[model samples]
Target: MAEKIFMKGCEAVAETAVRAGCRFFAGYPITPQNDVPEYFARRMPEVNGVFIQGESEVASSNMAYGAAAAGVRSMTSSSSCGISLKSEAISWMAGANLPVVIANFQRGGPGIGTIQPAQQDYLQATHASGNGGFRMLVLSPMNLQEAVDMTWQAFELADKYSKPVMLLMDGFTGTMMEPVELPEPLSEEEVAAIRASKTWAARGKHGGPQHKVMCGPGLDTRISQEQMNERDAELYESWKTTEVEYEDYMTGDAEIVLTAYGITGRIAKSAVKLLRAEGIRAGLIRPKKVYPFPDAAYEKLPLEKLRGIVSAEMSIPAQFAEDVERVVHGRTRIVTALSSGGEVLDRAAILDAARSLMK
Candidate 1:
């Protein structure tokens, strides 16, 4: 019987993954994200699943790689430092088209960043961690429920594309305790549906031709190039379906739109409520799907009358603001309000930006 439960978001991720029939969990413990692995370790054995606390984040990621190659639903979890170590393995898994789930419970910075939550890893999670060319399907979770729901769905998405999906949650959401209505466990038929498309997975033959899921290692360069193009096209198409999750409050006729997502969006929503109460005619644009960003969302916006778009981000240089600028298409001016070094944005700062825009 599926029911509401009080649990930390990280704990919910483990519960949800298990509910989705995940059979393998491999990860190195790193603060903020450690609860996820610990939960799996505690519960996985009950379901006859395997949860291994690897030697290191590097090993954890590779273990997931090996499990995915063996045709099992596997996952790994880490924060910034651990995520950095998963880079090479992530690249190899992508090249091999292995289906796996990895989560970056993002904490601040470049080297040994703090355990405090930060959105600074935006470039890392979306931009292939370290490698320059590859793209990863990065899903940003705003609340505990999204963390749990997206963790389960990540496996399905990964399996569908035969790629790795990162469920990016901040330290706040991961550690925050919340009550969520967890979905029911999938039926055996549903499990078979996931396995059916996994013909490319390394499952034993069922009286069918031999199967293979490999990288570009063919002697024929032309054929290898074609396959590479196909993978890129598929990744792009996947991005097209990405989303931004947010709730709009009283944005019907406002000229200046405040765009924020994730935890920042939650705070922005609060700002919206306060501003509305103060007789400020401000509207909010919250993007729930940050990647494959909700481009269609813009069609509903009034661009011409816009004074300027204020991008409220948890990091400096306005990581998301740049993307917002691209989608705005010069239809309006763009300004950014940032909280550097993984700092939280001041609510008054955002409200002031809105007040200034109206001037």
Candidate 2:
């Protein structure tokens, strides 16, 4: 049995990953997400695993790539700028179909943005996490508990799709302390089973056919291109069926829906409560997974009573709002309230936007 505790978001995610039988970790610490590695560094020794702090984000990502290629569950974490350095590595990992969980404790950006939570990276994670036409399942968690839960799921999705999975949770949502339930670490029996069942692992001493997991080999460029195309098509196809985490709060009879994710969704939820207190029929659509955005989430809303959709995000321009538009399909107007890092959108601003849409 796992113990329940109140913990920070990043810490919980780290513990969750370790408990799930992740044995390799390579990362550089940044604000908000720094605690993740700190916890792992202390906790991993108990399980006799490896925790390496690479010289740079580039080195850390490469280490993660190597670990995953060796067929062990591994991970890497970084903030916005750090994520930038890791783009190439992520692309390569996806091509090789190496499954490693990535945690991007997002914050403000464009350059080296502040250490404040922001959902602006939605484009970074959703549209093209890496370059090219490739795609990975980007799982977005809205709170501390969700952060932990989704980290485990990310590993599962990555291995299943033979691709990388990023757990997208922002700084505030990643750093804030919250209550959560945790499961006991994977047992030794489970670890032994994983090692023995080398269906796709590079177990160092193979006595069978050569197993080469590479997205691109210098010899056969065409094969690489074909694989990329196939994976891209599958990713898009999966997008329709991939929206696994989405919730509608007080939206049953709502005319206008507020769309947000991560901590911004929490803020929007508070705004919803206040709006309801004032007899405003407002609702919120909180998306847990941003990449494979939910399909037909607002199906029941009356088109006539529907005034408009409002997006509150910690980005300068609305990042999460665009996904809402993709989901809306011309059913309503789209309004966005923007903020970056420390500049959070006020509840009064959201309430006013909801009122304006009604009028």
Candidate 3:
């Protein structure tokens, strides 16, 4: 039997990254996610992998980019502010088709708003993460166990698509501790095999031939840039068909359903149960994959049965609510139950909203 270990969500992510064959990690300390780098700084060395605490988030992102270009399973992580600093590198990585794992343990933020958990970065995570209109596979894990699982899968998805993959969560998810049965760690041989398979990895040519890995605007030529953009667009569209994940909880028989992600999704799930106990037919459409937005899941909902769709998140003006609105497409009235500035949405608040909407 797999032994369940009690671990903080942040530490679980770091440990799982290593187990997934990640050998290079660079990050700076940021509140709500500091334990990620802290764990990597200690564990990476033990595994004979490299860990660097860059002077700034920008530097950390570039360092991760370089490591990934060399075909190492590499990653960087930060809060929303730090992610903004890393944006340029992220855009560059996407252009280069570099596979890298990134995590955003978001905090309240327009500009350093608060350090407590909040889902204020929904727009940043899903719609416009970086320049050049690049899209990433964004996974928002609701619990420590899911965090571990998602972090483990992130490396594979990043490599498979040759693009950055984000593990998006909040401070509450990052700092919370829970019992989890982590997956088995990859062996040294297994890690080496994975690394060796990347034919483009930066190994010296022994003075024979040199290869170039370019991620710029492509030789300053219109044709080159156009070709690059088209290829990127194709990949982005492919994700819509290939990568979408969500959970449907009693939605089959529901009249009121809630939509949420990350920590807020967990809260909404609890709210669904509370409503159920009170004889309300509430359900939840909790998205595990935020980007590729899980639109198909929304389309699959029993629209004829739904009375209302409530978006439960912790953001002002409700960033994710915009996507939910688009998905619902005027089929039913949409509403929001939001808790901002580090506040968790009260379960009762969500329950009451669903009840009132049904009435």
Q: TM-score for all predictions?
A: 0.90, 0.93, 0.96
> Among these predicted structures, which one has the highest TM-score?
3
Among these predictions, the greatest lDDT belongs to 3
Local distance difference test, candidate 2: 0.79
TM-score of 1: 0.90
User: Residue 117: error of model 1 in Å?
Assistant: 0.6
Off by over 4 Å in 3: 206-210, 220-223
For candidate 1, write residues 228-338 as lDDT tens digits: 757676766767754344456667877777888778887887887777787776778877656666666665688877787778878765678877877888998777777
User: How far off is model 3, as Cα RMSD?
Assistant: 1.6
Tens-digit lDDT string for candidate 3 (99-214): 89999999988999899889999999888889888899999999999999999989999989888999998999899999988899999999988888887666766564656554
Segments of candidate 1 deviating more than 4 angstroms: 130-132, 187-193, 204-208, 216-223, 241-249
Clashes of 3: 0
lDDT digits (tens) for residues 1-359 of candidate 2: 45679998888898889888888898887887898788888988988888999999999988988887776778999888889899888888876777888889887888888877776688888878777656777877777778878888887777667678888888887778888888667796786566555466665546666655445433345466766677668776766675467878998887678888877887888888787777887899887777677756755566546888888888877777777777677878878877776666687778888888867
Model 2 CA deviation exceeding 4 Å by range: 1-3, 217-224
Cα deviation in Å at residue 53, candidate 3?
0.7
Give the TM-score (vs. native) of candidate 2. Answer: 0.93
| Candidate closer to the true structure by TM-score (higher is better), 2 or 3 | 3
lDDT score for candidate 3 against the true structure: 0.89
